[model samples]
Target: MSQTLQAIYAAKRKARRFAVQGIYEWQMSHNPVHEIEARTRADNAMHKTDLGYYHELLSEVISNADVLDALLVPVLDREISALDGVELATLRLGAYELKEHAEIPYRVVLDEAIELAKHFGGADSHKYINGVLDRLAQSLRAAEKQQAK
Candidate 1:
């Protein structure tokens, strides 16, 4: 891939990492998304992150959490409230991307969420994330998935 493309992907990955943390924090603290975003920007080295993408992911996931949870409900093996914090946040982020960010491939969303789970969730949470997001993609990105096969 070209250098520019690789840089874009790296920036997006940074955005995902920070967005997951922000979402996790919001889940735990009930803080406003803008407050979380401001705090994150102030506390972290976000120079390399895709700031717009980070903002979009953090804001959209938090704003539409109920809607995202509704989408996740059908595929969740257990109660949504029973989910681990990291897993819930990662899944919400993944589900949001699957449903709203059609420009991003579903596989990329799954991979990124699995990475987030592996980094921040309990052991084996990545596997669960993969399974749930895979199911989500089937429904939300069915056309893209069929074309990829």
Candidate 2:
């Protein structure tokens, strides 16, 4: 890939990392999305972060949390409420991307979510996340997946 594309992808990955923490915080504390965004910007160095993607991921996931959780219900082995906060946050982020961002390939969403879980969730949580998001993609991106195959 070209250097510019490489930069964009890196920035997006950083955005995902930040969004996971922000979403986890929002889930735990019920903080307003704007407050969480402001606090995240103030507290962290977002030099190369994709600010637009970060804001979208954080806000959309919080605003449509119920909808996102509903999408997760069937694929999740346990209750959504029973999931570890980080894992839940990561799944919601991945689900949002899978359902809303059709331009983003499903495999990319799954991979990113798994990476986030590995970094933020308990040991072996990445495997669980991979399974859940893989199932979600099957339904959410069935057409795209079919084309890819």
Candidate 3:
């Protein structure tokens, strides 16, 4: 990638990493969203992250978590309660991006979510994340999927 594109990609990856952590904290502690964002920004190297996207993912995903969960629950093999915190947070972020971020390709969303699961969740959790998000993408990005074919 060109330097500018590379920078943007790195920043977005960093944003996803931090957002996943923030979402996990939100899920486990039920902390306020702004507080989580502030704490994450304070504790992390924010210079390299896509701060705006991080805020969007953290704030929007948490705010719409119930709806995201409702969409995800049907695709899951087990109950939402049975999922690990990391997997759940990653799924929520992925679901939000798939449903709301039309500018981002569905494949990119799935790949990022899989990466999050691999880095933060159990060894096999990426597979489950992949399965759920893949199904979600088919529904949410139906036209994009059709175009790709």
Candidate 4:
């Protein structure tokens, strides 16, 4: 990957981490994204460079979340709404890439989510996340092909 792309992914990983924390907060209080964004920003416990990336990513994902979740439901036979906070948000982040940021190869997006799932989500969550993302990537590619024709 180019340095810029690597920087972007670094931003995305940070975003994923922030997204996890924000999602957890949303679940707890059902707060709006704007409020959560402000809160996450208000603290910034450290003067860290990495936190900025995560903060921006979390903001984007949270802001676009309704549309993102809409894309997820059809792929899942069960109501994904009932999924754990981390799993649901992780899927949203991957879906955001698949649906909105098609510039990134679908496989790479899925890979990022799988890596996150393995590290952060529960046992077997990686497998579950992988399955959903694989299907999502295929759909995204198919849609792109159709749009091209």
Best-fitting candidate, measured by lDDT?
A: 1
Better of 1 and 4 by TM-score: 1
Residues 1-149, candidate 1: write the lDDT tens digits. Answer: 99999999999999999999999999999999999999999999989899999999999999999999999999999999899999999999999999998998888889999999989999999999999999989899999999999
For model 2, how does the per-residue alpha-carbon lDDT over 39-101 read when each residue is reduced to its tens digit? 999999999999999999999999999999999999999998899999999999999999999
Q: Which stretches of candidate 3 lie over 4 Å from their true place?
A: none
Reference-based lDDT, residue 44, model 4: 64
> Model 1 reaches what TM-score against the true structure?
0.97
Better of 1 and 3 by lDDT: 1
Segments of candidate 4 deviating more than 4 angstroms: 1-8, 45-56, 143-149
- What TM-score would each prediction reach against the true structure? 0.97, 0.97, 0.97, 0.75
lDDT of 4 at 70: 81
Score candidate 1 by lDDT.
Answer: 0.94
lDDT of 3 by residue, 1-149 (tens): 79999999899999999999999999999999999998888887799889999999999999999999999987889999999999999999999999999999999999999999999999999999999999888888999989989
Against the correct fold, how does model 4 do in TM-score?
A: 0.75
What CA RMSD would you report for each candidate?
0.9, 0.8, 0.8, 3.8
Q: Please tell me which model should have the higher lDDT, number 1 or number 4.
A: 1
Backbone clashes for every candidate come to 0, 0, 0, 2
Query: Which segments of candidate 2 are over 4 A away from where they belong?
Result: none
Tens digits of lDDT, candidate 4, 42-103: 87653333666566556667777788778787787578768877788789888877886778
